[model samples]
Target: MAEKNLLEAFLKAEELEIQGKEFYLDASEKAHIPSVKDLFKQLAEAEEFHRIKIREIYQTFQAKKNIPAYVTKISQKQISPVFDPKEIEKVASVVTDLAALEEALRLEEKSIQYYQSLSDKSKDLKVKRFLLALIQEEWGHYLSIFDTMEFLRDPSSWYTFKEHWGLEGV
Candidate 1:
């Protein structure tokens, strides 16, 4: 049935959120740099929020019930890894900080694409709106990661604009 399909879609999205959270949490734990560690923790928190939201949506539609009043909660949980910790560790060990940030950026971009496709497929107004909101949220995640990536790639260039140095390359 179409409703079953929608539920499955949400469940898949929820799985991605969990995986993302787990990846970021592990990355934060492994990172030595203070700023990178903090960024990863923040990203993990956002992914957990998305996981809860997607689960709420799945429950609402699965039971043919209305959307519940939502509240944001920040809690840590142990989720099964979708990506191996060793793999992330390898990247951390071998790659630059920009590479790790790029990985997060890629994940956010992929999530946005998935949400956009889901929104386009949805015929119901509520389903469409829900997916649209998710897309917007994912965009915000992408932008944050991108900004961090830019800063990490070139600290002087990134801060020069705000510092009003009027230098092309700082």
Candidate 2:
């Protein structure tokens, strides 16, 4: 992995947030299910928030040329996931549940890796905490996407089981 200064890293993260927001907006427009459409719209808003957060951080700390102390240390855990390209086929529209879920999964997985990397690299305690918060948020997003995929795969069974287990109000 290539090393980047904090400003550069945050700038890259901001760009990613913009892309994520755009993708979510497009997905919302193309979604067939009302619930999925709402989900995408909500995620788009969240991405916008993430973008602003990163931008603020970058602007505040861009003058500092300090490389994080942890940057030189070897990472103990492999944070990146290996996904098959064939599993992420491009779609003109995210109208189908399966297609949209696949794309959402991909995005969440990528975000998880990105935020985790930032968390791992940050030496400042406050910065590390903020990055870890983002990581946790991304992990939650990934889990939600995974759950939605499972529900979409077998709605009847999943929904029924959830309702039976008193977990239907989400």
Candidate 3:
């Protein structure tokens, strides 16, 4: 396998993920709507998981090569997620569940893009594949949030097993 310079992008991905998690956590605490707060909290944890996955990739590189470049003093600070404090305060009060859902979707999209960039930069095919998987997973997360938002506001779309089985209206 060719040596990859994907270390930079991967590190950035981790930094951004951490930043996103912090945003979500902050929003969760400030949001007045219970459902929205819970949703934000869920997203915060999700971002943390994504960050862990990226860290695992770095560790894998270290374990496999036992090298120095992978073991660096450099932190993933370049692509770190940064939310404007004023914006957070403003949005926290006015954001509905739908709005928060949309923001979460955007954040997940950012993660997907970062992962895709990192994956493309990876020289090792295994790392590339792992990153691709992460990208797909992030897309799924974005979609799931959209679908959940849909379900939350539209209970008519939700069908219980009994209803689907024609056991309802009894």
Candidate 4:
């Protein structure tokens, strides 16, 4: 049934939220730099909020018709390793703080793409709205990271208007 399919997709989103929370919390434990550690913590908190939102959506769907909610795809393949610690290792080799920030922005941008696709796949309006909000939050987080890193690299460049905004800024 179409409803079943919708429930499955909604459940998939819930699972993703849980996975993200776990990853962020674990990374927070391992991060040495205070800023890095705080970033992880902030991400984890966001995930937690997403998880709650997903559950609320799940409950809403169930309440609509008393239909049981179930997800068929518990897939790692759908999950992008966008937040992998390996990103930092590789970025560190090529550059320092500014480059590091750029790399994270890239990752977050990629995640926004994934979330957008996933959001499009959902039939429920509430679910779609939640996904859109998540995407926006990711954009904000990525911008914050980029701006902070820019500030760190050049204190004089605080709020310095660039010749052009990158994709993230736009």
Candidate 5:
């Protein structure tokens, strides 16, 4: 029964990843800024990678009738900031970009919740670990979107705060 539940969860996760990838691709196509477009493209790739991993795990579990040992190390590619300070002024007019970022945030939050819920219910250590890794990745995506949103809202302030820059003489 537990195995069945795990298999069902894997299927659901794969569907979620596919949805995320499609959304990111659409967002990338609609993005006005090159940096934002690149970010969305990277996110789409990450979602595709997740889908592939989930499919592989599902096949392995189905064949072995046991959860395979998951590696503790989850590799994530570093994503650069979504805007350059010089081009930040141009982003002020990008309301659609902001809207897309908001939607991305919602999607990532949903994925994190779904993975966390499944991880909480899982009895198998390997299954739990795998879900936890996914949760971490989704959380990273959420944070990246959030930071980009903040940058879009006020690039100068975001940079000042993020960089911990203080006025030494004023």
Candidate 6:
């Protein structure tokens, strides 16, 4: 019964990753800004990686009837801040960009919540750890999208706050 549940969770996770990858790919193609496009591409790659890893784990679990020990080592790529403060002026207030960012944020949040719930229900420590790792990656994606939204809304304020530059002198 537990194995069935685990397998179901794995299938759901893979599906979510696939959806995220497709959305990001489309968003990347539609993005006008180079930085935004690159960021979306990076996200799409990460989602693809997660989908692959989930499939591998699912196959291993089916054959072995247990979570793999190496599952803990599965990690997503760490994405650095892509938006440059200098390029802030170049980022026009495009409604589609903001709308896409909002949608991306929603997708990431859903993934995080799903993983967290799955982790809580998991009995195996390795499976729990794997879900936790996925949750963290989704959170990273969420934060990246959120930061991009903030930058789009008000680049100067976002840059000032992100860079920790004092505004007292002004």
Q: Which candidate is the best by lDDT?
A: 5
lDDT of each: 0.71, 0.67, 0.63, 0.59, 0.86, 0.84
* Model 6 C-alpha lDDT versus the unseen true structure: 0.84
Off by over 4 Å in 2: 1-4, 63-95, 165-170
Each prediction's number of clashing residue pairs: 0, 0, 0, 0, 0, 0
Better of 3 and 5 by TM-score: 5
Summarize candidate 5's per-residue lDDT along 40-100 as a digit string, tens digits: 9999999999999889888988887665567564556865655676778687788999999
Candidate 4 colliding pairs? none
33-130, model 6: which lDDT tens digit per residue? 77788889989999999999899889978887666463544564687557866677667756788889899999998999999999999877888888
Q: Which portions of model 1 miss their true places by more than 4 Å?
A: 68-94, 167-170
Per-residue lDDT tens digits for candidate 3, residues 55-151, read 8777766566533323221233122122222333343345365676678778888888877877676676666667776776676667667654554
Candidate 4 residue spans exceeding 4 A from truth? 65-111, 148-170
* lDDT of candidate 2 over 1-170, digit per residue (tens): 22347778888888888988898899888875655666777778778887877776676676554423322212122222222223233322333856876888798788779878877877776677667767776666677667666555655565566558654567
For model 4, residues 1-170, the per-residue Cα lDDT tens digits are 26677667668766766766676677667654455556757766776776676677677777775323343221212221123333433333333444444655665676678779877886655556666877877766677666556545543444335433345745
Better of 2 and 3 by TM-score: 2
For model 6, the stretches where C-alpha displacement exceeds 4 angstroms are: 70-73, 167-170
lDDT of 5 at 80: 60
Order of quality (TM-score): 5, 6, 1, 2, 3, 4
| Model 5 stretches astray by more than 4 angstroms | 65-68
Question: What overall lDDT, based on C-alpha atoms, would model 5 receive against the true structure?
Answer: 0.86
In candidate 5, position 158 carries an lDDT of 90
Error of 4 at 163 (Å): 16
Error of 2 at 101 (Å): 1.6
lDDT of 2 at 142: 71
35: Cα error in model 3, Å: 4.0
What lDDT does candidate 6 reach at residue 84? 63
